[model samples]
Target chain A: MSAGVRLEGLRKSYGAVEVIRGVDLDIEPQEFVVFVGPSGCGKSTLLRMIAGLEEITGGDLYIGERRMNDTDASRRGIAMVFQSYALYPHMTVRENMGFALKYAGVKKPEIKAQVDEAARILGLDQLMDRRPKDLSGGQRQRVAIGRAIVRHPEVFLFDEPLSNLDAELRVQMRIEIARLHSELKSTIVYVTHDQVEAMTLADKIVVLRDGRIEQVGTPLDLYDDPDNLFVAGFIGSPKMNFLPAELSGGALTLVEHGGQTVPLPPLGRAPQEGERVTLGIRPEHFRKEGSAALEVDVEIVENLGGETYVYARQAGSDVLTIATGGARGLRQGDRMTARFDPSDALLFNREGLRIR
Target chain B: MSDVAAHRLDPEAAEPSARAALRGPDGPGRDMIGPAVKYIVLSLAAFVSVFPFFWMLVGTTNSSYDIVRGKAWFGDQLLVNLGNLIEQVDLPRVLFNSFYIAIISTVATLLVSSLAGYAFEIFRHKWRERIFAALLLMLSIPFAALMVPLFVMMASAGLINTYSAIILPTIANIFIIFYFRQATKAFPHELRDAAKIDGLKEWQIFLRVYMPVMRSTYAAATIIVFTLTWNNYLWPLIVLQTNDMKTMVLTISSLNSAYTPDFGVIMVATVITTLPTLIIFFLLQRLFVQGMLGSVK
Candidate 1:
């Protein structure tokens, strides 16, 4: 059975320094929500607080209809997969998976049935007799997942579970987790610094920064319509390129690039003349057919067979990543005109808040 | 060819042969001298350490007069000396007393010390490091200073002449607590977190997860504490009054301090006293090495 989580005015502090400052969010039942942020942003701390691993300094936490702020982690009906896997080194896979059940006073045959079912689901049947040390990193992670699965909790918490794996294994396990989530349909809260993992696996993504929520939305919602500069910059793979500009006479002028001008996109409220702003554009948004163009010199070229990313810039200006679709001929020092639609670019005020 | 002619004929061939000659065993660059010195030093140190034990074994076979005369060879007096050792002391009672005290002290010390170590490392509080530093500082105070106070406390409790007095003082050993605290640093804290999530109480986590994971540390501590408790002579000698309560080491010392001491019998008792510690050491030798290196892989 799945249960929803609601956090209201959640706050956590160590001594005088507050780490999770006034966070409020709702995780719907069976919704896979990912908490994404850079290091020291309190995403993991928030997840831990939700899992009852950390005490709430001042807040209300509800799992299903019951308040869970003071509940023990085990009693909260939640299972957490740690970053280190956290498997017991001395126990075999079977014993490790069944340890909780054994301690919970489950009968021997019932514990065996549950552990065996989890093992089958995770494809850990052959490895049941092996200790954690004897298994590969991927296998150990699967056993950790199996250990959690055998609990059959209402909510699942994952704390960067695939971060310790190699890239290929990470992708493999990511798909495995997605498939598991789909099968079990349990409310899951996952924490990760990797934006790609958040974007790919999350039904809803919560962007946190410096102990506060920047924005919370569906993956595409955050990507297409970010509420702030931080969420816009953090949610994408190749970071959005920002150009310092001034809104003068209804047109934006690039201050650092010799006054190159582009028409400002229509906004809900008109900005003041001579208002300083930042224009953000994604690398892939630079299309050949767009109306606006910037003449620049290519400094470096990175070709990954399918798409090439050219790092180019004007003289005395910051470099911008431009995605050249299958243009293999571009090389360093090649002068080119990168173009994009004016409507696709976003503007931010000087305070790093989105203008529209 | 002459050296100059060979170099002139083929520079590549000449250079390789010259390099090989310098690297060869008999060459000036050969590294034999340092290793030879090291081996010589090591052999001498080994002999210095082992000669006393060898002399002890030989003393057991020789008579008292021969031992005093510095007789180095084995004689046929082993059975006689063993018989005399058995007659002078109740061998079974002393042996039982030593074993009982050592085993109980070892088990209790490991439990109490490891729990303290684990708690010190895992739990957070304002006074944790201050308390630990104070404990470590207490280690610098010589046990001789505490012996009188400890004896007085034991006497007040009416615990003197009791095994409880022997076992109780050693249970909270600071040195072992330090060792376990250091080893517990290597323990993965995530396991504790996982056990908590799995619904284990703190003590249950210690008994089920920590104890098994830190078995190497336990093994090493067992050998050390067992040896120390078994070889403990002064405290037991002072507290234990009756002949029936004497430990093997105490009895051996008493035999040595007699008006007319028998060296052969003393040597036999010494051999017997040394055997249990040796057996424990050998049994836990591998794990002890691993524990000294690190408890967790």
Candidate 2:
């Protein structure tokens, strides 16, 4: 049976500086939730608190319907896979998988069966007798996951489980984890700083910054409708670009780009005419030709076979990245015209909060 | 005709004269001389370090008078030295006492220290860290300063002349604790968390998970603690007041102090005292080195 998790105003602090500042979230049963943030943003801390590995400074954690704030990690029916794939170095893969089950009051036969089933799922049947040192990094990671799987936990917690892997192995393991989630249909909470992993594996992504939640939504929801500048900048690769602008007469005019302006749809209320704003645009949203255009000096062009990214400057401000299809003939110091639809732009206030 | 032209045009065919021109004169002998001197120096150091053990073996086969005269080879006095060693001490009992203490102390030290080390590393509480730092400070306090108080404590507990008196005081040793703590820094905390989620309580996790995972560390600690406890002369001499309870080191000390002290017999006793530790080290040498590397990493 599976269970949902509810963290109500969960907070963690060490020596007065709060690492997790009052996080509240309701994770539905069998949903894969990812806590994505930069290092030290307390995403791992929040996951640990839910796993009962870290003590909650304040607020309540409920697994299913039971309050788990004071529950021991084992009693909470949770299993965790760590970034280092902390398999027992001395034990065989089979023993490593069955070690916890031995203490969980499972019969020897049952334990062996469970371990065998987990090994089969992780494709580690041939490596059952091998110690961790004898296995490669991917196999060792599989053993670690198998150790967790044999427990049949109601909730699974993963603390940056694929960070130690190389790029190719990380992608492979990421797919394996997605498949495992679907197969087990268990509620999972995964933490990582890599937004690609977060976007790909998560049923719901919780974007975090400075120990606070920036936004929580589906991956596409976050990409399309970020609630803050941090979320917009963090969720996408190549990151969303921000340019200084001013709101005037239902029009957002780029202040730093030689006064290039775009008319905005009429809002019931408007900020002061000269109020400063941030114009956010994803690199892929930049069009080669459109009704609105901004002339920029191309400083660098990276041709990645299928797509080309142009790093350019408009009116001598921060560099803006524009991703275009196919190989481009753009070169350094070449003047280029970049265009986009007005609807593609995201508007944020001076304080980095989304304005609309 | 074309093949004949290609063979004539070949580089090897054309380079016979150039080969002699490219052969330069021999280089200087400086490089060979450096390694030659280094080998001589290293062999000399090895000789100096190993000479005493060789001398002891030779002395065991010589008469006491001949040994005193610095005789350096085997003689017909081996039987006589063995006889004297047996007469002067209960050799078997003394050897047994040394072994029993070392084995028990090593096992107990590994268990207690590894437990404490794992606890300190896995559990991140304020007081535990403070206690750990305090333990390190305690390690720096010389054992000589605590010996008298420790002796008094043992005497009050009615543990005088008993193996427990010697073993108990050194069981919670700070050095072993510190060694385990350092070794434990390399232990993946993820393993502990995994064990916890696997439904293992603290002690179960320690015994089943931590102990098995840290085998190399335990092996190194066993050698170190065994060597230290087996060669423990002062504490054993002070605590073991009875002749029957005397360890090998204490017996050797007493044998050297006797009137007309038998050098041959003393050599035998020295060999007996040193053999157990050497055996332990030889047995666990690989694990010991591996453990050391793991800790430093």
Task: Give me the candidate number with maximum TM-score.
Answer: 1
Q: Which ten residues in a row have the lowest lDDT in candidate 1 chain A?
A: A263-272
lDDT of 1 by residue, B85-187 (tens): 9888999999999999999999999999999999999999999999999999999998899999999999999999999989999999999999999999999
Cα RMSD over interface residues, candidate 2: 1.2
After superposition, the stretches of candidate 1 with alpha carbons farther than 4 Å from their true spots are B1-30
lDDT of 1 by residue, A120-220 (tens): 99999999999999999999999999999999999999999999999999999999999999999999999999888898999999999999999999999
For every candidate, give the share of true A-B contacts it also has. 0.78, 0.94
> In order, what are the TM-scores of chain A for the candidates?
0.99, 0.97
lDDT value, residue B171 of candidate 2:
81
| Predictions' DockQ, in order | 0.76, 0.67
Docking class of 1: medium
Please report, as a residue range, the 10-residue window in candidate 1 chain B with the lowest summed lDDT: B20-29
lDDT of 2 at B53: 97
Residue runs of model 2 more than 4 Å from their true location after superposition: A265-269, B1-27, B125-144, B295-297
Best by lDDT: 1
